[model samples]
Target: MIITDTHTHLYSNEFDEDRNEMIQRAIDAGVSRFFIPAIDSAYTHSMYDLEKAYPNTIFLMMGLHPTHVKDNYLEELQHVETELSKRKFYAIGEIGIDLYWDKTHLPEQQDSFRKQIQLAKQYKLPIVIHCREAFDEIFEILEEEKSPDLFGIFHCFTGNYEQALQAISYNMKLGIGGVVTFKNGKIDQFLNQIDLKHIVLETDSPYLAPIPLRGKRNESSYILNVVDKLSEIYNLSNEEIASITTENSKVVFGI
Candidate 1:
């Protein structure tokens, strides 16, 4: 019953007080694998230290998040490239256009997204995307960069059925999480029609907590809530959902 949380921020300051306890809670809940996404150079040390603390359970990814993509983005990308040269990273991640917060950086966000995709291909690593309010914009770039080697997860995917099929066309798997448990989170409506192979579980924790805990801080242990919802949606047992999604994660992340 090993489960994988393909995206989470255990390194986040929000968890500073009970990080270890929270991780233990998740482990107890059958979440053995936790893939950590990087925000920027600032969190690099914390991410490495977290991996060191839970070497086997915790995995690390490096990228400049779109919301963080500002005037100094070039220097940030340099840090990502330099880190890749220094050691192994599971992916170049949490990268893509974010028009929700501020559209002013849309152009720079697109440029950064493309450059990072190139970096991912160069390193033969998967990418974890963070897209918000820019589906058309993000898909536009993905269309241009589509290739046999360009592949990754559409993290925290909250798009339509057509978008799901479209993302798969580009070799990406949908990262399902807390949203699936929300009563109005529409993906649950058509999810059963989609293949489980195209899906993976995430919490995006300290964020989108599943209902029963929505609007509250989320943790990987709560990932079980997501699994339960998915089980109901796909008409399978929790173990069946967990095993398949964990396997799907391995296929995407190569872990």
Candidate 2:
């Protein structure tokens, strides 16, 4: 069962003491590929270091996260452009409107999201979104920028069935993660309605740990927990769920 954690922050300081061991735990649990998303210029080196440490399994995305769209956003976006010009990246992401953090930067967040989507199209790369309490805001920009070239994952998707359909219409796959196991994580109620082709598994580690580990620090190894939950949601075996979702991730990340 080759599970793919399409969105994770393995480079995060959360695992500083046992990063390799933590990653190995995931590997042992059959979670192999990890797609790391960029937050801003600040974590660039750490991300690169992680790539070097796990060249065979780690893929990176470059972008300015919406929460980071502060006063220095223009400069940050410039950094994203510069990095893209220098080398290859799997996607431009973890970018989108995040009203949950602060509403003051809504305008800047929307602009950054649109500009980065253009960048993704320029490079013919996928995008990984990080939306929170801004579905309508994010959808507005996606609507204006909708095109064959505009496509990616709706990371940590926690919307209704209609919103799921709306995101799919825009060529996006819904990123499922720890939330699928929550008692109140509503996505599970209708997730079966969306085909496995439009679904990809993720851990979003150091955050959103599923089930028994809920509210605790999450790691890639816990992706098995997600797989376990997916099996129930999709009415398939764990290996089958892994196979389907991993293949779905390939469709999005082009891995």
Candidate 3:
């Protein structure tokens, strides 16, 4: 059973001490593919180092995260463009509007989101979105940018059935993560209603750890907890769930 973690920060400092061990742990747990999301220029080198370390397992995306859309966002976007020109990237993502932290940068966040969407279209790459407390806002831009070329995954999706439909309408596969295993995470309630094809697995590790390990730092290995939960929700075996979601991930990432 080859599982795919479509979104994870394997390069995050959280795993600095046992990075290799943690990754190997996940690999042993059947997670062979790890799609790494870009935060900002600050972590670019670490991301590259991670790719070099696990060239086959680590896939990279380049973009400025919404939360990191500060004053110098233009320069960061330039860096994204430069990197895209230099080499191949699976996607342009972990980008979108994040109003939970601070609404002061909403305008800049929206602008950055739209610009990055454009960049994704230009490069013919799927986008990985990082939306928080801004589903309406994110959907607004997605509506304006809707096109055959505008497609991606809604990373860490935490919206309702209606919003899920809206995201699907825009060619986005909902990224299911540890939240699906939480007792009150809510997405689990209607997940089966959305076909398995519209779903992909993620851990967002070092964050949103599934129950049994909830409130603690998460790792990709814990994604099995998520797969087990999804098994119950979709009424499929764990291997089937993993196989379908990993295949769905390939559809979105084109890997």
RMSD values, in order shown: 0.6, 0.7, 0.6
For candidate 3, the per-residue lDDT at 132 reads 95
For candidate 2, lDDT tens digit of each residue in 164-250?
Answer: 999999999999999999999999999999998999999999899999999999999999988998899888999999999899889
Q: Of 1 and 2, which scores higher on lDDT?
A: 1
What lDDT tens digits, residue by residue, belong to model 3 across residues 64-171?
999999999999999999999999999998899998889999999999999999999999999999999999899899999999999889999999999999999999
Residue 20 deviation, candidate 3, in Å?
Answer: 0.3
Winner by lDDT: 1
lDDT for each candidate structure: 0.94, 0.93, 0.94
Number of clashing residue pairs, candidate 1: 0
TM-score of each: 0.99, 0.99, 0.99
Clashing pairs in 3: none
Candidate 3 root-mean-square deviation in Å: 0.6
| lDDT score for residue 73 of model 2 | 97
